[model samples]
Target: MKGKLRPVGSPVPFPRISERQELPWAALYHTEFMGSGTEALSLAVAIAIRRHSQVSTPEVIIPAYGCPDLVSAIIAQGAKPVLVDLLPNGPHMNDVGVRGATTPSTVAVVGVGFLGIPERLEELSGICREHNLLLIEDSAQCFPPASASKPHADLVVLSFGRGKPINLMGGGALLVRTDLAGQAEEAVAQYPVSVLKVGMKWLIKRLLFNLLMRRLPYYVLERMPLLGIGETSFHRLDTISRLDLPESVLQAGLRDFQRRPLIHQRYDTELAGLEAWGWKCLASDRSEMSRNDPQQPVPLLRYPVLAPSKDMRDRALAVLNSEGIGASAFYGRTLPQIEGVEAAVGGRDYPVASDFASRLLTLPTHEGVTSADVTLIGRILFSVAES
Candidate 1:
């Protein structure tokens, strides 16, 4: 039976121009805005290998259980992607896997901080330096704290997609280390702004997403596969192109970025409530920042959990849908397991990634969700887990 609907993620509230604020990191790094995270990644790869003297095929190492866009971005730059497996608890790449995957052709390694928890970038950076490879940090879901130290990566990418850390419906940014600023700018100069038609399409998509992401509409629309709401598919590399970020989206992203502290508080409250109810989250508190100060809060893009098994996860999703709570099996499969992608990228052994993919589920931690909603969600999760 259908129940009350609570979405796992919420659209950022429309921005108040009066609230526009400056971002600290903006001043620390050389930043360039792009249409999406994929564009930023593609540009980063281009910059990283533009002057390489290697005669062998250029390759970029990526997490095995990541969004296909990561692979597509590398392929778009005329480079191949070498996939590495994740640590057992996931979404951090395994050090051994990354070390083993590095080939002479490897030009860079992308360290992804899945679901807002930063990866072991310091360790990865040391490895990259040892191998003379560039380290690119994919913080699409993470918004670093203003007071925190900069990441050890040579380049960092941020996204402002519909559900990203700084959602503005559509936009992304590349934060290049000063040393690579010149080359990065050169690569960015090659791409032209998206044509009027593409801009219009993005505008339309933004409007539609804001409208349908709500409870009632999402419940009905989500079941309609033709609409493709929340559906995942492998897109072609050729189709990846740079688009202009609408002025409003830029303003909204800046405003939202500044407001991250408040959002982090809400997530902390919700997460604590869930933990109190005996629900285990996928993200561990032992991350770099937490280990430094256990009392410090870590902001999340979504609160992810790993069910006992795929069947249990599916049953929980069914219950959450019927109850009108937004819950999802995020990235139902790992990178290589994604349909239509294996043929394009070639296959690799990734048992740990495949298993992690099957069990992961996410709950909403957005501003639209309330403490009462969180309590109910905890109860729902507890009930499902027991069942």
Candidate 2:
């Protein structure tokens, strides 16, 4: 698999912290660093809600088709998750579904920008304000230009996890609105800084993943659950522990963040080539969102496309995998269907989320993938579709 185009994310480099104080988006809002995206989100939820005796079970609205970590974070904060379905054939949450899900117990709503595609944030922010609910932007996958203005959400969360836009292997940041900064600062003070051993472990893991992912070695390693390579499973609420972001990891992320412009440009050119071949993407292009400037490009983590059915998606993956072209089926199941999350979601049926999960396939757009690789992938995909 030496020549394979690895699906999703680029390799993370080792930390070299030239100037920690000048990291991107540092001055935009009050920032707090954590060990993982899940910790940052859990901390934000805890800071947002006011515990009341009248409201025994607080709830937060999240997209039905999202990372299981979102649900875990809410549960960790002692709040129930209210799942809302996505729009038909789109990654953004349905506005109507979000509004309908809001109730007296709903204290907040989280809008997740899946796969570097921005969600309908302005609209979602307006709805949250009208209902007196806090709005949290999970921009783990979406990384805008470093010089751009901050998003409209009350709290913004960014992930530097293994497959995210800025891959530092393990780190996250939470930016709170001016009004909530004081409270957020106070809330996070209690958590301890991450240990040096953990940071070392993360660095080792990062090196290993970069070397083996999308390779034949990874295909064999991923099957072993203990190795934790591309394995999806539910994490318990108790596992959401708070730890500070290591300085080494922070420096590594800053270096990667600085390279966004070049990455975004490459993605734009390759994505256009694929689109010219008449393939439809799962999420809307960045240019489609109002906040995104047509002149400035935002890099996508992967190029996601929709297959006609689950069988087609599986067949496509098989063909691509055999040819050393890394194509993947992302989120094999919807949020509520994940093991141990059903009780938290009340076992609601989300038709749109279910359908989207079954049909979605993501292709590589990392620096390692070339324009010629996209043409080859396009040919494979076209063949799979015609069959």
Best by TM-score: 2
Query: Please, what are the lDDT tens digits per residue for candidate 1 over residues 1-387?
Result: 243344444465454446454454555577777768888888888887875646358989998888888988888888888888888866889999889988888899998887777888888988998998989888887766321355488888888777787766666777777767876776778877773233556567767877776666767877777877666788865643466554555666556554544344544454564545344576656363431344565557777887767887888888876677777787888887888779756787688888888888887777666677667766777777666
TM for every model, in the order presented, reads: 0.86, 0.87
Error of 1 at 147 (Å): 11
Among the numbered candidates, top lDDT falls to 2
In the order shown, the candidates' Cα RMSDs to the true structure are 3.9, 3.4
lDDT of each: 0.72, 0.73
Q: What pairs collide in candidate 1?
A: 3-322, 4-323, 4-324, 5-324, 6-324, 6-325, 6-326, 7-326, 8-326, 8-364
Give the alpha carbon lDDT tens digit for every residue of 163-218 in model 2: 88888766687887766787576567767776435466666886787887655665
Rate residue 54 of model 2 by lDDT: 58
**Where does candidate 1 stray beyond 4 Å?**
1-9, 12-20, 145-148, 194-208, 239-248, 257-279, 284-298
TM-score between model 1 and native: 0.86
